[model samples]
Target: MPPAYVEALGSVAAVLTTFCWIPQAVKVIRTRETRAISLTTQVALSVGVVLWLLYGILHVSWPLIGANAVTLVLLIVILAMKLRHG
Candidate 1:
């Protein structure tokens, strides 16, 4: 595959995964209810995202790095809300 095509694929993947948390994050922000959220899930996801970010950095892939960075922040917010409202 061409390099540009590969990069485009990665960017699409990054965009999807990064924005997947938005709905739940918005709900939490509005409702402030996170009792149903799982700490294990959140922690696992955060760790996974961090790992992806690190991998992106190592690979020098800006799309992956940027997507994961934003996702990490959003994940942190959800985790905090879960802790507060659990």
Candidate 2:
């Protein structure tokens, strides 16, 4: 395992990157304007996030697992919105 400080750093980085999707999610939810969103990109990104989550699980990396898990949820929400609104 890495040092505690290293893990903490990873956690901080994970939180920042993971929550960065919030603004976009909020905008999509509030506006319900998903016509500009691309289904293909969302699908691809969701798949990639899933894969990253899987990789994190396999490696027993908490930061990677947590971040990717949250990201996957956000991606799903956006993708669902895109499908519903577009």
Candidate 3:
């Protein structure tokens, strides 16, 4: 495949995954509640995101870096809120 197409696909995947977190973040923020969320799941997700960020850096993947950076922020916020409220 062409570089343009590869980049486009990567960008699209990044956008979709990044946007997917918005709803969860907004819901947690608005409700200020996280009782329904599992602690194990959040921890695992945080670890996964961190690894993805590192992988992105190593690979020099802009899409991975951008997407994982935003996702990491969102996850951190949600985790904080969960700890505070739960």
Candidate 4:
């Protein structure tokens, strides 16, 4: 396993990148405006995140697993909104 500080740093970075989707999600939720969002992009991103999550699970990497899990959920929410709104 990596050092404690290394894992901490990984977790910190993961948190930042993972939660960065919050603003987009909140905007979509509030405005119900997803016309500008690209279905292809969201689909690709969700698939990538799911793959990353699977990789992390197989490797037992907490940072990757946690980040990708949350990212996948956010992407799903956005994708669902896009489908519903558009």
- TM-score: which candidate is best? 4
Question: Quick one: how many clashes does candidate 4 have?
Answer: 0
Model 1 poorest 10 in a row by lDDT: 10-19
Better of 3 and 4 by TM-score: 4
Question: What TM-score does each of the candidates earn?
Answer: 0.82, 0.82, 0.83, 0.84
Candidate 2 residue-wise lDDT at 32: 97
Which ranges of candidate 3 are over 4 A from the true structure? 1-10
What would the per-residue lDDT of candidate 4 be over residues 4-64, giving only the tens digit for each residue?
9897887788788899999999999999999989999999999999999999999998878
lDDT of 2 by residue, 1-86 (tens): 66998978877887888998888899999999998888999999999999999999999988789899999998888998899999
For model 2, the stretches where C-alpha displacement exceeds 4 angstroms are 1-12
Q: Arrange candidates by TM-score, descending.
A: 4, 3, 2, 1
lDDT of 1 by residue, 1-86 (tens): 99999988977887888888899889999999888888999999999999999999999988879899999999998998898888
- Tens digits of lDDT, candidate 3, 1-86: 99999988977887988778888889999999899999889889999999999999999988789889999999998888888888
User: Model 1 segments beyond 4 Å from truth?
Assistant: 1-10
Residue clash pairs of candidate 1: none
Per-residue error for 1 in candidate 1, Å, reads 10
lDDT of 3 at 25: 88
Indicate the residue-level lDDT of 16 in model 4: 84
